[model samples]
Target chain A: MTQTLGITVDNISVTYSNSRLALYNASCYVQPGSITALVGPNGGGKSTLFKSIMGFLEPNQGQVDISGLPIHKAQKKQLVAYVPQADEVDWNFPVSVWDVVMMGRYGYMNLFRIPSSKDRRLVKESLTRVDMMDFKDRQIGELSGGQKKRAFLARALAQEAKIMLLDEPFTGVDVKTEKAIIDLLLQLKDSGHTILISTHDLASISTFCDRVILLNQTILASGKTEAVFTEENLAMTFGGIPTIRNEERGTRNKEEKISTIGFD
Target chain B: MILDWITEPLQYGFMVKALWVSAFVGIVCAVLSCYITLKGWSLMGDAVSHAVVPGVVVAYALGIPFAVGAFLFGFGATVAIGYVKENTRLKEDAVIGVVFTGFFAFGLVLSTKIPSNIDLFHILFGNVLGISQEDIIQTLIAGFITLLVILLRRKDLLLFCFDPNHAKAIGLNTKFMYYTLLLVLALTIVTALQTAGIILVVAMLVTPGATAYLLSDRFERMLAISVGTSLLSSILGVYSSYYLDAPTGACIVVLLTLLFIAAMIFAPKYGLLRRSHSTIESN
Candidate 1:
């Protein structure tokens, strides 16, 4: 029997301690082997949804099932690897790039057991995949912003997880590093790894993503990249605010325009 | 020089006992502080050290071995800080500040009210010269146990410190690891109080680890460097205090501070002075 990398969200909702509802009755299914870009304005519940899926937060009213296992269950966490925003880590922490990547294997290795030769090899391979092998011995604090993000990506890649949830992986990264990361994600998708990334860069959405999930407190729309990027849908998803402008028009206009664009 | 110092100290049984006790405390605090410094819990040492004062005062008032009272009080303070940090919006440092200051102030008030026979200065600044043989053996046993526990759980403790999220995702009990670390820290601080005193215990807990951090990125190397620095500083400080008629705890802390400053200037990689020099050379 063929196995499916499935993510089934059933009526999930979340409310912060200050009594603000971050998510409300949101539901979506992530199909296997695809890049799904979750895009929205800041504080629009994108990160909250990703955390909920990773079982970091208990939904106030719904369930997330991944590969037949519930989010809260320990077995399900093994199937999903999460790359949190790089800014969340303390760079002053005394550790090398290799050490950080080795942490990815912690989920598979025995909790008290030392990493074996195989684990070391996997760390090296992951670093090499990110083209960071030359700087393996360098401390995390010594790396640039883009390098730090790539190192985190290598750490997630080393987890060998079936599904990867990345939050703002391309934020503040230079275009070259961003393209390299997107290329790596594309390769991973081709290799049957389900990838979901939360991002704000609408320009790269069509080029890098196979599908787009536009969320604003709830799932406004989710479908093929071309179908979901319509001007009307973008305005609705962004709270009736237009985000794109044609430079050829020379001046700003509030009038809505529908344009067909190919992936760059 | 080593033989001369060893023989002269061994001639006086008390000196020999003091040296052994200091060594024991040095080893225990050195190993335990590696974890504390790495996890950014260096300030917890200061909290526990000051928290023990009230326990020591109460025990002295009751005419008992002060270690029992101090252990209970120090461990209680640690737990209180952990509890408040978990249950309230207060940060860890704020919780520690409230808990330690309350206990320390209570101890200070009690010291002033109690009989003049017990010297308040002696309690605050420990007298390594007056260490009893029983104290030496007790500290050795505690140190051995602390070392064994650290060695056995080194991997788990390291994982918890570096990345707790990954530790949890791996099915490791992160809460258990955190509390276990606090317990070890409390025990280590209580043990070191015998030799370094409450005022200087933080020096033993923080200085050597911080010095090691400047020198190495590998955890194992850092542990070794910290332990070595602690041992060397303890012996040198004790000998210098004996010869120069200085306060032992102060002498030890001063020596540790000097070593830390030297490492900050001389060590490669993360050292500030070294980095500046390298930058100049590159330019």
Candidate 2:
């Protein structure tokens, strides 16, 4: 049976260390076997949301669940995988792509036991899925930016997780790499895996993702792709002219009144 | 003449002990240095090494094992640096600088004030020629434990140092991994004490792995290369010291430094002279 996990974020809020900066308050559900894009501006708390979901940061209030179990609990069962931003990785560290992909299988085996044949086969298969089998022996640093992203995706796929969280997988990657990633993601969704990607780039939302969560430090809107991805929602998420015009109106009115008075 | 040079050192029990002792320190430090270089913790290693000076003095005053004091203050300095970085706005470099300088100064003051029969220069610069049998056994045991732990957990530490977030996401105990590396570092420093001393410990901890990193892009090869450099340098340093009438510790450091310079000039793809980036940029 191909089991999939649905994600639930119930009133999650985060604050910065004994400070008044309430980074975000979010509530959304990501259905199983679908691609949900977390859309927001830079510093719009997108990465913060991803961090909280991955259990790296403790949310001030609320819970994240995958298929009715808590995030950590689901994680302990080897049901979740996360691909960090490419820039966050240490490219200079000496490791091969095969070893990097093998890292995903670490959670399945107990300490001291070598990876089994089945596990090794899965790692090979994961690389094949991402078209990186040829580069398995290559050191990760030797790969190009796009190839690096593909290898990272292979690592995540090798996890065999029901839920995958990718942060900025498309950022700085070329068009072909992005298309390859999209194709692999669609294949995953077909095989009953849930994937949530957090990115600032909105262009890929309509094409690659089936759902959208528009965010600006808080949940502005979220639903099926066609229902929630509106001009107004995007305007709000990107701080487009509508929101900027409101502040502009106040200054413009004041200037007009001063000119009408016609005095130095 | 070279045959006499090699046989003369083997004649004395102490010289034989020092050679084996230096080799043990070289192997452990070389292995641990792979992670240190990868994690960009060279300065941190230097800081922790100097920070242990007061601990050694205090342990001597209190009549406890010097390793205990070194471990306590080594971990303490790391924690203090981390605390200062988190609680205040100080960057890691600044925090490390302030805490290490303060601790090192405190150690110096304690060394001067206490009237102990221990040679302060020996404590600072090491006296490999004078290490006792018990000291050799301790270094052997410490080196064994460190090597065992690091080898058993090599994959985990590699992932943790390379990408901690990915490690944690994959259910590795990154906190445990972080502290384990620190503990290994402290233990490795303890092992290097009698041979390298506190002053030369940083060199043993950082130089070999750094040289190896420039030479290879595979961690396994890097380890082999690092251990090879460390063992070669230590043996050469100990051997040349007798004929040159120089301190064993200083001799080891000078050899390691010369090797580092050589690696920088001649390393395969990344060498200063053979780099491809410069050619590409020129085009």
Best DockQ among the predictions, by candidate number: 2
DockQ of 1: 0.35
Candidate 1 residue-wise lDDT, A129-182, digit = tens: 999999998889899988998898888888888888899998879999999999
Interface DockQ of each model: 0.35, 0.51
What are the chain A TM-scores of the candidates, in order? Answer: 0.89, 0.87
Against the true structure, whose TM-score is highest? Answer: 2
Off by over 4 Å in 1: A1-4, A8-27, A57-63, A75-77, A144-146, A172-176, A239-264, B1-7, B57-69, B107-120, B278-283
Question: For every candidate, what is the interface RMSD in angstroms?
Answer: 2.8, 2.1
lDDT of 2 at B182: 83
| Per-model TM against the reference | 0.85, 0.91
With a 3 Å backbone cut-off (N, CA, C), the pairs that clash in candidate 2 are none
lDDT of 2 by residue, B170-277 (tens): 777888988888888878888888888888989999999999999998999999999999999888889888779898988998999899999999997789888766
Error of 2 at B18 (Å): 1.4
User: Could you give me the TM-score of model 2 versus the true structure?
Assistant: 0.91
User: What lDDT would candidate 2 get against the real structure?
Assistant: 0.85
C-alpha-based local distance difference test score of model 1 = 0.82
Sort candidate 1 into its docking category: acceptable
